[model samples]
Target: MLNRIIQQFGLQVQSINEVEDSHSSTVYKCTLSSGENVFLKIPYTKLKYQRELEAYEILKGRVSIPDMLEYWTGDEDCPGAFLLSELKGKPLTSKGSPTVAFQVGVLQAKMHTIHPPAEKVLNGIRNEYTNWSHFIENQFYSFAKDVEDVLPPQLYKRAIEKFEEMKHQLPPPDGPSFVHMDFRPANIIVDNNKVSGIIDFESVRFGSTEMDFTKLYRDFLCLDTTLYESYREGYNSIRTLIDLEEVLPFYQFTDAFNSIGWCKRRGMEKNALFLEENVSIIKNFIL
Candidate 1:
């Protein structure tokens, strides 16, 4: 299958190195015959391929994202893959610092400026939504199904109540905005302490801007008072930072809840530590 793609594009390869593997995609750094380098990404599902394809189109000129060089929508025997221009940098670790947090905030604010693409720019994307809440609600319902057997009855009931109670209270962005639904420290690539690129757009969608800040704050910015303030300063430099005090807790709670479902789908026992962590987080939200 890979041979067919390389042959079709006439990609004369010298060396191929597997870089990152996740539930959604298998990525590799491939050196071409001409000594140039590129990334080959094979998405685990068709939905991920479509979502990322549209996302790259929306973000190419607006921010520092990888350029889509070539792609193949393969058939039953061959899975689809993307050949993208490489963005050189080391990915930040999960333990984010003030510098990483600030850059992330600045980059996210920049991304918020990108609205939904013109109809002409998109392919047939099945994931389009009218409002961000509907998108989130749909996600909650779906995740709920995956973890119904695992979460305690009382916690599960309250989680649903919390989402129902707070989901409606959250406001959409001033405009329909592109959100990196899975943004985190590991996804941010840096060089010399500056953000060089933002990768992984498979989970990208048009959603509330505040929704984008959940994982960033939970995993990084909230680590220290100075880090939180620095992130805000960086974000404010690009565009006005929205008031999160009123709205952030809701997203935080739901994100933690969503994490449980994520673990269940992958394998609860293998992801037990992460699963335990999210369960602890959910308790904090309810308590």
Candidate 2:
């Protein structure tokens, strides 16, 4: 199948190397005949291909996303879907530099400028909200249930009650924006202290810009506070509407729950340590 693809594109296949393998997909680095580099992402399931393709289509020409060369569905030759695009530069972490976080913040700010279909955006949020306080009562409570076994019952109860009490203080959700639901450093690629590209649009959904920002603060900030400040500067430079103080606690709580859930799912001892530490941090702030 790969041979046929190379032949159709009139390119020689020098070598194919596995880049990253995950539960959903496996990416390969392929050097073409003209010495050009490209990446082929093969998904484990057919459903993932459709979501990725839709996301790519929506994001193309609107942001610093990969250029899609070709996308194909299941066939006798290739059983699942594949995406071909010019490979971007190395991930920010590869350089062992701290500036990448600032670049990510800048890129995220640019991404939020994109506008997805409005009705779709509204519908997605409506589906998640059951009432006026649904964000706190339903969403956070549901997340807590998933990690209940690992959490301190008293602290967990206080966190939920505090969130419920504070729920009314939150302003109405902001105007919808194109949000990369999973905006982590891993999904970003950087070179020369600048973001080369952003990948992994599988979780692309239209919602509050804070949803994206919260993920950034949760993951990258754990490494360095300076990085978080840098990112905030970049983000604020592009859009000034975000209320950082109000959202900080919510993000902290969400991050704690998310970390515990991840640790439980992966059964990783290091993640367990992280969960405990972050839980302590959240408790300190809430109490």
Task: Find the candidate with the highest TM-score and give its number.
Answer: 1
In candidate 2 the C-alpha lDDT for residue 110 amounts to 81
- What's every prediction's RMSD, in angstroms? 2.4, 4.7
Flag clash pairs in model 1: none
For model 2, give the 10-residue run with minimal summed lDDT.
Answer: 121-130
Estimate, for each residue in 57-173, the C-alpha lDDT of model 2 and write its tens digit: 667776788878876666665535454676466755633345666667677888787665544433122222223345435556666765676767887677667666665667666
Query: What TM-score, computed on C-alpha atoms, does each candidate reach?
Result: 0.89, 0.74
Maximum-lDDT candidate? 1
**Residue range 16-124, candidate 1, lDDT tens digits:** 8888535578888889989999988888788788888887877878888888998888788666789999778778665556786688778888998877656555552
Model 1, position 196, has a per-residue lDDT of 84
lDDT of all predictions: 0.80, 0.65
